[model samples]
Every structure is written in C-alpha cells, then in structure tokens.
Target: MVDDVADVAELGVLTASAAEWSVAVRRAEVIGRLAQEPRVRIAEADEAATQLGISRRQVYELLKRWRAGSQVASDLLPRRSTGGRGRGRLPEEVEALLLEVIRSRYLTRQRRTVSAVYEEVVRQCRTRGLAVPSRGTLERRIGRLDPVASVTARQGADAARALRSAGGEPPVVEGLLEQVQIDHTVVDLEIVDERYRRPIGRPYVTVAIDVASHCVVGLVVILEPPSALSVGLCLAHMATDKRPWLERLGVEAAWPMSGKPREIFTDNAPEFTSEALQRGCDQDGIKQSYRPPGQPHFGGIIERLIGTMMEMVHELPGTTFSNPAERGGYDSQASAVLTLAELNKWLALAVAVYHGQVHGTLKQTPAGRWEQGVAEGGRPATVSSETAFLVDFLPAERRTLTRTGFTLDHVQYYCDALKPWIARRRQLEKIVLRRDPRDISRVWALDPDGDSYLPVPYRTMSRPPISLWEQRAAVARLRELGRDQVNETALFAMVEQMRQITEDAAARTRRARREVERRSATPVTRRTPQDPAPLPPAAAQDPAEGEPVRPFEVIEQW
Candidate 1:
C-alpha cells in the first residue's frame, strides 16, 4: 500500500505532516462512503481492511471514531500502542541524571560516543546507590535528541552552521569592472627559453577576473616569479584595450574587455602590498581591497578560472598534470615544445575560447554576461590612457640628474632633453625615474617643471636591450668571476659570454644523456694506504711552558 504520509510529503504540502493514524482515518472515510449504511458489515470491513493493510477490528474501530465527529483525520485514527516489556520503567531520577550527563559531559564537551556516556553514567550510578539503564536504552535516549542541537553542543558554531543550507551574504557585484579579483598562479607547463629554445621551467601567469561577468580582463605570463613588477604589469594589461594584443598573438577574435576596475580584490600577497601598485590605484581612483588572512576561499572565483585555463594548458605538450598521480611519469621538461613567446600566443587564443565558452555558474558565456552587464548601464571605468597607465604602474626610483644623466644600478641613461638640468645646481630635489622591470633599455623621467615624463634611453645605441633580471644575473656572474667594478660595457659583454656558454653546455648535456655509454667494470681494491709514519714523537711534542711556541719565533725577530 502507498504511504499517504510520504505521498503528501512528496507533493510538498507545507502544513502538518500526514501521520500513520491520519492515513488510516482516510482509509476509513473511503470505507464508510462505500458501505452507504448505518453500520459497516463484517465482510465490508474485512474488504476495506484488506485494501488498507489493516485488521477488520481496526477498520471498525476507525469507523466508530470517524462517526464520533472529530474535525481532524488524525483524531479519528487509532492511537499507537505503548508500554512494552521494561518500557517506561526507568526511574525519573535515573532518567534525569543520564540526560544531564549526556548534555553537559558528552554533547557540550568534546564529542563522545553514546557508549562512553553510558559507561560514565553507569560509573556514576555505582558511586551512588542508583541502578543504571542498559546500553540499548541509553542509545534510544541519545537518538531522540535533535541532531543539529547535538552537533552544535559537541563541535563548534562554525562546524554546526556549515551543516545548514544557508550561509553568509553572497558577493554583491552587479556590473562589469565593479569588483575584480586578481591572483597569480604558475602555469602548469614547461616553456622553452626565448633564445635557446630549451625548457626553462614553468612561468607564472597573473590574471584579473571580473567578479560579476566572470570574464578575464587582463593576463600576464612572465618568465619571472610573482612579484610587485608582475602585479604592476598585470594591472597595466587590464587597463588597456586587448585588440592590439590579440593581433600581436595572431588571433582574430574581438576582445573588447578593458578599463580601470572600480575596485580590485586581491589576497594578502606581498606583491599586492607594494607601494607602486598602491600609488597607481590611488592615482587612477581604483579601490584596492585585500582578503582576510587564512581565508583563501573568498577569492574562489579567480582560483576556479585559473584551474579552467590550466585545463587548456594540460592539453598541450610539456604539461605538468594537475597532480603527480595524473602525470603518471610524463616528463614535462623533456617533452616541452612551446617557447615562452609561443605559450603567450597560445594563452591569448585559449582565453578567447574561455570568453566564448559557457560558464556553469553564470549559465552563459563570459562575453554574454559582459554584454548583459553593459546593457544594464554598467560600463568600463576610464583611465587617462594606456601609455599613462603603464607609466604609473612601472616601478619608480630616485636618481640625481647630472651632466652624465641618471645612473640606475650602474647602467647609464642619457637624453638631450635633460641637457638643461645637466651640470646645473638645481634646488635639492631628486628626479623620479620609472622603468619597466622587464626592460631596462629605457626609463621615463618625471620633468618637474612640465609635470610630464620624458623618455631617457641608453647613450650607447649599440648596446643590446638588457632586462633588470639579465643585469642582475650579469652582475652576479661578474662577481663570481672575480670582477668587482662593473661597467655597462663590461656588464653586457659578460652577459653575452655567459649566455652562450650556458646554452651550449645545456645542449651538450642533453645530447650526452641521450647517447648510451657502456663500459666494463673494473676489479675493486680494499687495501687502505698505510698510516703515515707516526709524526716524530720529539717533533710532535708541545713547546715547553712559557717558551716561544714556533720555530720561526724562536729563530729571529724581524
């Protein structure tokens, strides 16, 4: 027979539950209407009992209760049987004592099993002159307590609250560029070096995701690890239109997402706390917020997007699969086929795919969400200009303007525009020089009088473009080679010398490993060299107390 209680529940009736008694009363009503008489016949009652899966006596009893005229079906149904053997025999005091221990000692403290609580109760009963209930009886009592209440008492508020369906307020982002999340993750693929085309390990990819639309506004894949410079470049990327960038990558899609975000959400990474980033945001009127410490899930949107992007990366060669188990002995470095530049281009195309693909949470493509946000009066925040944004975001250093121009980390930069300030005793003011950490060939100098920046390039036009990383590496190489006084000419020369040798050595090593070399094993020798003739006993003796200690001192005073 179908359970009316469960059926009513499945129908989603929000009122009181349909108990077994109410279900029986419903069957009785059907029986009464079928009988169409003052009193129900035994065969009629038996038929109803068969249909309802009840006894004839129960059918007649339900009919009698129904005729008594109760408005509710449950009231007309038979009451449940009770008072079986040993039931309700627990003394009131014993019951009270057990409940108190369970509530105060077990539930309210560290979680304890019912058996443990029962044993404690039994022990307490032995201390006093009271009898203890059986373990089965105690288990029934424990089961009757509200599960949620018990969990709250035994565990913690956070744990108990997590069990519920509801939670804290959802993020309130309503438009594109309203709230943006930025994070850095190392791309799970080995990329070759730009020059040598040899695997140079993985690169870090910094991404900025729009919170409302789930669109990637900006991304930067850098050879260097995550740092303040990477963060600055990422923000610069976010503020610029991506059409030219896409074209550079040879992609045909239209990526119209760009602009200064009104607010950027980031974690408490040291790069996010950098002065240049903070100043740029302040100058551009962008609000910056850091996630609270230890709670990484607050930035789950960007993390998930990074994971999705990596899924594309995993499809390529040289991919370090998500985990060691998934990789299954794949050699990412050995199989590397994409150079950093190629990876950059591939990422640009892959991101376009992401923008067009449907998002599970938003139920639409990110581009579609962006369009909807635009239709609802959401627009991109404006910046002065792309070039200006880059200048603002670049790391700054203080240098004195002299006849030779500014010298940053021993690299000389000169421009004809600085001639007026050259060799002139100006007021005590230091010029602010901003340089891209990736490329140090040129720097932007703030012109105090005009309040604009002037580009200063290396005086020697023949010098190759040197990055900050390369410059530092060259300095370290020179130091290792016993050259302390470094000049720009010597620095570049050393960097070129080291680069060729390092690349050649790596290539040779790779080739050598591939060629199998076989050699015959030689017989081993166990004999140890005899101990050197014990140093002469007379010569080894210590100098006499208060006597000059060495032969040189004893020989003569210079």
Candidate 2:
C-alpha cells in the first residue's frame, strides 16, 4: 500500500507540472463550495465546476452546502461576473488617459521614477474627482499597462535604424603613427601676462595625440589660433623634450619617415587650411584629414582632455586683471601685476601635475606612454630641428628689386653669408626674397637656378622733421639771394597750417578738461536742503528800504 501511494503521488506531481490549473484545483474547490447556492438545482454547481475544470467531488460538496441553505445563488456565479454585465479592472477610458499622460510626460523625459509617476497619477485623479490609488496599486497597474515600455522600445528601434544607416561599425583606429588627431580648445581660466599683470587674452589649448597609444605627444597653450607659427613652436618643443626617447628607439627625427600619415585629423578651422600650414605639412610630408562637420566625437580623445583642463582651471582661484586698461576698467596696477604673477605660477603647477599624473585611458602618464612607445620600436616621425628651422623660419614674399638694391617698403637688406650666391644671382636681374617674420632686419634672396638662398641685411632710418625756426631761416636766405627757390607764399601757407594744427590741438585739450570738470561736478543724487538761503537780490537789498542797492566805496585816511 505504501509503494502504491508513493507511485500515485509521483504521478500526480508529473500530471500537474505542465497543466495550468491542476495544482490550483483544491483552492478553486474551496472557493466554489463557499460560493454555492441553494434552491436553484444543485446540478448548476457541478456544471460550473466542470466548466472551470475543478474536481467533481469539490462540485458535489458545493451543491450539498447549497441544498442545506447555507449559501446564495449570486455567490455561485463566476468570480469576475458583474451580475450579467462585463467590466474591466480599470475603466477603459481611465486607462487610455493614463497611457496618454505617461507617453507624453514620462516616456519623453526618459527619467520617470515610480514615485514621480505616482505623484502625476494622484494629480490626474484629483482633477477628475477620483480616489487616489496606493503607490503599489498604481505601480502594478503601470506594469499591466506598460505604455512607457512600448515608447522606450520604439525609441531604441529608431536609434538602431540610425546606427544601421551609419554602417554600424565599431571605430577601429589603425597602426601607430598612421593617424594623428589635433584640436584646439579654450582653457577655462582668465590668464594674464606676467610682465603687465593684465588680461592677455583667452588662451587656446592645442593638443596632438597618437591615436594608437592614446598619448598626448604635443600640447601647447597659446594666445591665438593654432597657426603654422604655433605649430612650428610646438614641434620644436617636442623635438627638444622627446629627443632622448626617440634616440633610445633608434628613430630618425624626420617625421613620416616610412611614409606620409594615412590621415591627419583636425577640425575645419581656417588655421588648419591656411597656406602656411599647408606648406609646412607638405614640407614635412604629412597628409591632412578633416573630421566630418559637426562631429566632435570623431576626435573625442582631445575633447575629453579639454574638459579635464577646464575642470582644473575652474578649481584654481579666480583671476583678476591688474591692468584696468586691458579690460577697460579702473583698477590698481599693483593688483594687476600680482594677479599676472599668480596666474603664471598656477598655470605652471597645473601643467606639471597633468604631465606627471597617470591618464585613465592610457593607464600611464602621457609623457610615460610617449616614452614607452618610442622605446618599443616606434620611430619619432618628426623633422630634424635644423632642417625644420631652415624650412619654416624663413617667410617668403613676392617682391621686385629697386635700382638701389632695395625692396618695396624701403627695406635695404644684405647678408655677408650670401655674397657668393648673390654674385651668381646678380646676372638673373631679379630673385624671390624670403624674410624672417620674427626679425625684419634681415632678408634672404633665393637663387632658383643655383639652388641656393642668399641672406641680406636690412638698413632702416627715419628722416628728421624740419623745425619752424629752420623753415623761417631758409625762407629769409632765399629772399636775400633774390631767388624764387623758396616760395614765400607757400612758406606762409605752411606756417598757417602749423598754426591751425596747434589751435586744433589746444581746443581738444580744453574740451577734454571741460569734460573732466563736468563729470566731477555732476551730482550722483540731489541732496536734501538742511538750511534755506536768502535769494541774491533779497540779500543785496537794504533792510530799511527792502530794495537792491550798489555798495558805497570808501577810501582809507592815514
């Protein structure tokens, strides 16, 4: 018997596993028996239980109770029957309104919390004069409604479609030195010059990063756009600072040694496309590449660095301009000087901290990553300092020579180093002159035929201004000589012009003084009268006659 019972129990468990309501038969039977009715035939109980798939024994018990008059007919109906009408758990109209509100307000924001949604539900219920549901109840209803979920699913689908249209490929950067990304960001601090203690201008930060190692190879903060001049300066600094690493790696100083870069990524700013920048890159054998319009993420590494710089700058003390004139204000020069000194000190400290600290992405300091890459067989793809200086230091210009061996702008230049080249070029009549933008005191003449450049020194002098007494003396001398060399009428006209200029200058000075006086005298606000004063005419009148009279003159007798 025990063995048979075990077998039956196992069979029952197996039968109930895949069937929906076999396990709930006992609970259903209890509910049905409690809800059974009398007088209406007991057959109704068995029929209802059979339709619900409950056991016949449970149905018979319910019918027995109904026959005993212990239950009601209404109780024998289906659990959810509305007497004869069908109704939803929540009204269809209310459900639709809830869905609309959730879709419009909560789903669009993408930040709908359960509490926030509950508050909104309560507000809606109050407006409609309905009882506010409990938070749990509202939450359960929302789960059943699931409108927000549908909206989110739609949004995700749209995003996936966009990704598919964009080719849906993960960004894969190529080999080391294959691509270099450069960009400029404004540093967040107000920087002032050390010498003047005045706001110099907003500092522009330019960064060059190796796409493979994610290392900052070059960084510069200049007070202007990333011009070719700025680029050259940064390159020169890198050559000096990064030389030991490059030497250790046995790499040549000239950049793009193996081949030109696959791409040189930068923004579509004017400086990136300037003639000077183009020529410089051409000389260095680098090909330029630009990011797609409005796509900063394409060059996100540098953009993140810019954010870091801004955070650091913001943490520092607020900067003040010492030179009021720099920002068009009135302030102490001493304060401006102090501010400038502090700015430089803080900037240096910040840069040092940044260079020493380890970067999260590179897992090493920027300088360290750069060195490691160099030591690990990566070549320093940069031009030699001497060669770079020779190519970029000279500024070329198109000019014609004058009879006096001078160029336009009255610049007379000659360099002893170029004597041999100039001697050979003298036969060519004219040559292109390249001057140094930094120092206009010297210029270089290029001999295309000889494949040589000649340096020339420039001599500049200013003629002195003629004095008034000197002009008069010259006129008298001309008259004594009985010569029409100096025209007296013209000389007087010149004197008259000078007089007019002096008069205009004096008038300007007086006007400026008057303006200062007016500003000083104008009251900021009217003062209340403390004591009244007699009118001028009233004070001057005699007391006896109450009329104005002139004062009598008296002479002192000794």
Candidate 3:
C-alpha cells in the first residue's frame, strides 16, 4: 500500500506538498469510485465519508468537484495555501502596490539592495494601510522577473548581453535531426484582427532550429501565450512536412526541412517541462534535453534564429521595435494593417527567405545545409498525421466509461467507437484520454485492447464547440449567478453571451481608438492649407499592405 501510494503520487497527476498529495490520493481513491458509480447510494456515501473522515455533505461536494474536474487527482487537491503551492495570498491592492514599487524602485540603475528595497516597500505599504509582503516574498518575486531585463535595468545592457552567451564552447551534435532547439517570444509587432483590421495585440512565435544544419525545423505563431498547447503545436509544426502549411498559405516556396528530432533542447520553462511533453517524447523514442539552468549560450541557436525573425518582423507595419527608444514617437497600433492570417503569411514568406540565406557560422545557406545533411543522413523520419502525433503531447485526462458515455466538465462524449468500450467498462478501471484545450468538443481515448486512439465527440453534436477556457469561464459565470448546477445548455448559452459581449466591446474599442487618433493628430499649418491642403497626407498607409515585397534577403544557393 505504501509503494502504491508513492507510485500514485509520482504519476504527475497531482502536484502538491507531500501531505497535500497524500490527502489528494486518498480523496481520489474515494471520490473517483463515487464518480464512476452508475448511482451513488446513501450507504456508499456514508462509507466514503467515514473513510475520508469527512461529513456526508462534504463527500457529496467532493464527488461533484471530482466529476466536474474531469476525474483528475488534482481536482481533489487542497485549494488553500496550506494545501498546495498555489493561491496568491496577498490582497489585490497590496499585490498591485508591490509590483508598482518593485518596477519603479528595485529594477532601476540605482541598484538598491533587496533589504533597502524591502524597507522602502514596508514604509510605503504602512503609509497606504496595506499588508506588507515578507522579504522572502519580495526576493522570490524579483528572482522570477525576466533575467535579462533585470540585468539590463540594474547592471547595464553589455552585462545582460554577456549572459546570453552559451559559454566558451558551442554544443556539438552528430547528424541531421540530432538536436532540435526551440524557444518562444512575443513578436515585436502588433497584428490586427481579420474582421476589423484593428490592432488586436502582439502574438507569440515559437521557433525550433536543427542544431547540425542550423535549419529552422519548426515555427508556430499564435495569439495565445506560451503553454503546453502552443508547445505541442510548435513541435507538430516542426516534425512534419512544411510544404503543406506553405501551400495552405498560398505562397510558392521550398521548405523541405522536416522530421522528428532525436532530441529536443528547450529552456527550463514549465510548459517545456510538462508531463505531456515528456510522455510524448518517450512514446516517440525522442529524448528531452533542457538548457542548463545557468547557461544561456546553450539555447543561443534558437535565440539568434528568433532574433533574426523579429528583425524581419521589424520591417513590417505596426512593429513596436525592440525597445521604446527604437519606437520613439511612433504609434504602432495606429498604422497596424495586417491581420493574424496576413501576418502568418508574411512570416511564412520571411522564413522561406531566411532559409536560403547563408549562415555566418555554417557558411552555407540553411536550406543548402539541410540538403547536404539529408544526403549524409538519408532524411529524418516524420509523422504522416500531425493530429495523431500531437495527441500524445496534449494534456492528459482519465475517465471511466459509462453506459451513456464519458462525461467531463458536465459535457458527455459518445460515439460508436466507444460502444465496445462501454460494454466492457467493468473490465477496465479508467481509460486515459487526451484533449486539445483549444477545442474541447472532442477527445482522443486510448484503446485498452490496442495502442490506437479513438476520437470521441460530444454526445450532443449540435452543441457548438467551445474551448476549455470558455467552458471554465462559463462555469464561473454560472457560479456567480448562484447557479451551482450547470447543464450543457446553460454552459454553452453563457459562452455565447460572453462571446457576443466581447465582439461588441471590441467594436466599440476600435471606434474609440480611431477617434482618439484622429483627434490627437498634429494640426497642419496654414501654409499647407494654401498648398492644396497637403492632399490629406495620403492616409499614412503601411507599405507592407496593398503590395507584396520580393525577398531581397533571399540568397541564390542552388
């Protein structure tokens, strides 16, 4: 039983302190059984309550949480500060004050000591009648700040530049697809929405580079922040033929570099180190390698490649530039024209151009080097189906098959594919499932008899597809309205309302911004009024729009 408990805790399903994990495991054992029951009887509830040493009412509440949380062990994990390493204990106003003070004082050229900063923070907090954060809390917060940014702000730009070096020697790799390095950053440009052509926000770009040939193995641009989903998408982009993606972009270009890498080198980010990523790599016989915690140069290849890509983006409209000094007196959003799709297309072309350019270190075009590497290593293996390959890398869940179907977060999934599994449900304990958070309308369940996965769609097919975030938001909204029991209909209705509100808000925001820009414009002189009123300055168009630019950077290296 002890060994079993340890094994359960190691499954990565629940991350918490030891005591918290033990409680979670015990609760999962009880609640997981209750959730799977065709019908929970009073006797069963009494027994579970006694086992967990909790009230019968609390047992029912736990059962509800377990069922609604996709039957994961984490659903039962303690939520308070004592239970897990989560929950921001500080008040919102206090937290805001801490951040403001830290940014305005600590991260400056003055280079105040942590002790001095803490003293100042305490004085200000007291003056504002707010709870002061402990010294350790402030220190930890400072540690979590962007390292390069912190260094640059305190030490100097040159000192920060030194930290980016991979040390004295570069890592050595053997052949094609031997080592792939990936990293992501917010693109230095604002992109517009397709519907309104108004600047929505900057998107993140994740890039992967093959170490041996220095060829970009994969790239994905998304409006969302870096997460397991984005990482999986980027990896999928890297490990498949780029020609299909390029074709979809309708751009004529050659991007033949494609295949699964022997190993991946990434930064020590939570998303990069997720259990899903590790399991996926294990299943595909791929190795996982993290950049050394103190070494910045180990990830230099991908960083430099990303740097080049951002430079290319700098040439596009609405570029915020590398820093505020570079963007002096410029209004990025005012000139923004490209939509997300258009920016993606533009990036596709930029990548095509970059691939043909000769690398300073390799002394050969990335594409040419890739061809040579293929000649030497005889082409790396790649997956035929991107979705099938990606399913393993997606977030994992476990659910018991019911007669009707598998219900998760109040949504039931069913299909003919699950009919056989449903019949033999008693034979199996719980089957593992994988879900793409972007779309929760369907999930892939692992087959008990075989290694194949079966796609399970929503039992109510007419239910509009919604993201995991949308579902959670809808649930929260329902809870706020004192509607504890949320049905599929109610949840989706709330989602629709939320989406409509967002659309209306975005329209209003765009109109307001345009009006502000018009009002804030510099007045033309009277002399210009006499000279044909300067023809209204031709509307200050973005050159990237209304025309396609040839790749002046592309090198002829056939």
Candidate 4:
C-alpha cells in the first residue's frame, strides 16, 4: 500500500509536467498552512477553498491527503492514484531504478536518445523481472527534468550560466535550501591559540550561502586546513538548529535559517569531490553540482560573499590585510589577540548584523527575504538528528574488526555493540569506520547489515580526547625524540608533556596587549549592499551587553 504520510522532502517532483507542478506548488502553499492548525475552522476552510479554486469539501480532502503523503511540498503533488481509478504509480523499486538510470545515462554528456535509454531500461527490467515503462513515459520524464540541471549535465555549466536568472538572486532559485553554494578560503588574519595566547597562524573558513535569499547560512573556522571533514562539519551546522549553537557562543541574535539543501553547488576542489563527500551527499539525498572548469564566474555568488567578508576581517586586531601591500609590514603575529572561539563569536555577531542590513538588489534585509519565503512556501524541514546527519559526511576509514575491536592509527576502539559482530569477524570483510577529525575519542562503525551505525569508543575510556592534528603532532614529536616504535602510552605521554609546556608558558604572560585593547575599543559598522545604514551604538547591539566590542565592516557595494 502507498504511504499516505510519506514526508519525502526530496528534489523536484520530476514525474509531473512543469504546468502541473506549478499548480501543485500553489496548492502546497495554501494547503500547508491549514495542515498546521490543530483544528480547521469554518471561515478558514471556506477562504482556503476559495483561494485554491476548490470546494470546501475538497479543501478538507486535500489537507487529509497532505497529512498522509510526503508531508513536505511533495504531499500536494499532482497524482493519478488519488481516487484509485487511473493507472496507479509504478512499484517503488521499479520507479527508483528508472530514475537512477535516466539520471546516470540519459542526463549525461553522452546525451543518449530517449528511445535508446528506454531500451536500456527495458533490458534492465527484464533482468530484474520488473515491468518496463513505455517510451512515451520516458520522454515525458526527461521533459520534466529541471532545465538548469539538464543543460548543466548534457552540455556544461558554462552553457547553463547563460540561462541563469539575474536580479542579484541565485539563478533560478525560488525557495529556501533549493540550492546552497559552499566554498573555502584561508582567512586573511593571524589568530592566537587559547593556551598560550600566542599567534598560531591564519585559519581556514568554509562558508555556505543560500542562493535564494543571499543569506549566510553556514560557517566554520578552524586552525586546520580545509578538508572533506571541514565541509562535512559545515554541512552538519547548516542543517541542524542554530539556536543552541548561538546560545553557547553567547550571541543574542536571531539566525533562524536551518535546513538540508536539495541541491548544493560548489567548485571542483578535491574536498568537494572526495568519495566521502559524494557518498555522504548521496546518502543524505543532496544533489551536487560543480562549476565547469575554468569558469570562475559560475561560483560568483559564494566567492563574492566571501570577498565581502574579508573586508570585515580587515578591521580586526591581527588582520593580515589581504596582501603584503595591504599589510604594509604591520606585525600581525605580535598584535594577534582573539583565539579561534573568540573569533567565531565575533563572526556570529557580524553575520547577525549583516542579516539585518538591507540588501541593495532586493531592497530588504536577508532575514526579511528569508521570512518572506517562509510566508509563501512554509518553513523548510530541519534534520532530526545532528549525530546521524554528521556521521554520513565524516571522513571514512576501513578496518578489519578483530575479536577485540577495530584499530586505526595505533588507537583501539571497542563497545558492547561489537559483541554480536565478534563471532562473525572471520567471515566479515573490512567494515567501514567513520571518525570526526575534530575529536578522535570515538568512531562510528557501519553495521554489517549496512542500515545503521554503531558508536565505538576507546577501549580504555580513561584516555583524554584529542584532535587528529594534535595526535599527529604528538607522533611527530616522539619520532623527533628518536623513539622509532611508539606505543599508545608513549604517544599520549608526549601529548601531555606538550600540553604542560604550553600551559607553563601561558602562565608567564597574563596582561593584555595594549594595541589589541585600543583597536578593539571602537566598533565598526557593517554596511548594506544597497543603502548604507548608520551605525547603531555597539553597546546597544552587543550580545555581551557591555564589553569591549570587536569591529565588523564590509563595503556591501562590492
């Protein structure tokens, strides 16, 4: 039986025609509101029916169908099976296989003819003993594919660039989380470490910007270089609730944006193309698009936003100022003050300020544009489990599970969850393990059944949690000491010694730098893209209430 409450917040409904899908979206907008109310009222039902061009009874029927079907936009999709009189939908397995083949074979540079693709589908169905869809059906399916996606796949992104919509909005973006552009850059600022309060180096920042509203939806800053794990962490932040995150940062601001993107566009960097990222997006139902090689303009939205952000960084205490010419021999290392956490807090406040300022093209704030979108299409769905979503994107490692447990980088992991697999270890092949590069205290193991992941912690729970970079640094330190074969104990001992040395050094310098305090005393205002708004007193908007304020600036006209 077909599920009435399917809630499939997937990509576009490709099976329906564009005109039909348009009508469905309009209905979703109207019906989505009534579905949320605890009880439908007489006046409300009549108004909704009038807006939808349907009878009051039909409005009730539509609401019931939406509640039972894919609870998102797909719930209101046009279908032939509503009355159970027309040709019902294909079997789930058959439908999935057909879509998969069409996407992989037909929608490619090869540009196979519909007839050829249909024949291939027919052969696959015969092998699998499933019914073959007709050639007419295949052609219509191809016709219903998003034009931007079709051109990008069959021709190239450069060809698709000509088809993009203008007006400062993301090309062809009509809804939130429809397409997000994520990119990474080395921030042009030297940052200090939390331990010794000394300059560590410049850090990398990965940012995700929503195309529809030009909102900065996700951000990540770390001393480590950008990698697949950095992209994963940024994604995890993008989809989950940000309230708790903001509260922890002690930033009192409204950043209500959070949802999984239906399609994400990024540059063709190794981190963006890694198997871990590709498989993770596939697992989470995210479609990936890359800008064509040599076409820098394809990534203009994200790149431009990042460049604007760097202008704000220019006002900071330890700013490198973009280049040696801009720096003019200023000692960024000696003047560095803000640690990674403090810098992140400053960024949060800055983004909040940016969101409130009006966008020149849209003539409204980014947050206002976002709320306007919600008023029409409804709020996007947020991820239910942060851990589950993040596990899909974490860097993967394959290890053979012994009777005891799995080992990686000389560290062992075991849990009661592995007891069942221990007996079958000999028959089992190498199992996939995923560990967060940020924290290496535990790893998530893909179960033999391949459906769920099991959390495995260190065999000896007493070991302290450390980052992957710290672990490598410790190992390098031991090697420098002429210890050829290092054990787990020796590796941890070196790490502890290193931590003690940094702590003792930190004890020597307890006073704040005079230059850091002076520059940080005055707060700079973030200007809007269209019209520059006057700076509000920083103390009034400060999340810390009354404290030294970090400056924020961006010539939004850029």
Winning candidate number (lDDT): 4
As for lDDT, the candidate ahead, 1 or 2, is 1
Q: In candidate 2, how many Å is residue 92 off?
A: 37
Collision pairs in model 2: 253-382, 254-382, 255-381, 255-382, 322-336, 413-457, 414-456, 414-457, 415-456
Off by over 4 Å in 3: 1-171, 510-558
**What tens digits encode model 2's per-residue C-alpha lDDT throughout 1-558?**
333232222222221222323434543455445454434345665666667677667666655544553243322332333675422245444554455555555555375777887788878888987666677755554454333234445464444333332423436764655677777766545544432334443456676666765555555555444565455444443333344434433444422122123456888887677665675466555678877776556667667766676666655443223233543543322232223234434544455466667888768875565556557755554322322233332345656454434452333544344444445554655566654332343444555555344444443222122332334544665566675655434554554554455445433443333222222222121121222111111011222353334321110000
Candidate structures ordered by TM-score, highest first: 1, 3, 4, 2
Which should have the higher TM-score, number 3 or number 4?
Answer: 3
Candidate 2: Cα lDDT at 527: 20
Q: Model 4: per-residue lDDT, tens digit, 158-242?
A: 7787776532343588799899999999998887756567776777899999988999889988655789988987987888778
Reference-based lDDT, each prediction: 0.68, 0.47, 0.74, 0.75
Per-candidate total of colliding backbone pairs = 0, 9, 2, 7
Model 1, residue 14: distance off in Å is 27
Q: Which stretches of candidate 1 lie over 4 Å from their true place?
A: 1-167, 193-198, 378-385, 419-426, 449-451, 459-461, 509-558
Compute the lDDT for candidate 3. 0.74
Candidate 2 worst ten-residue window by lDDT = 531-540
Question: How many clashes show up in model 4?
Answer: 7
Error of 3 at 119 (Å): 38
TM values, all candidates: 0.63, 0.43, 0.62, 0.60
User: Candidate 4: which stretches are off by over 4 Å?
Assistant: 1-171, 477-484, 501-558
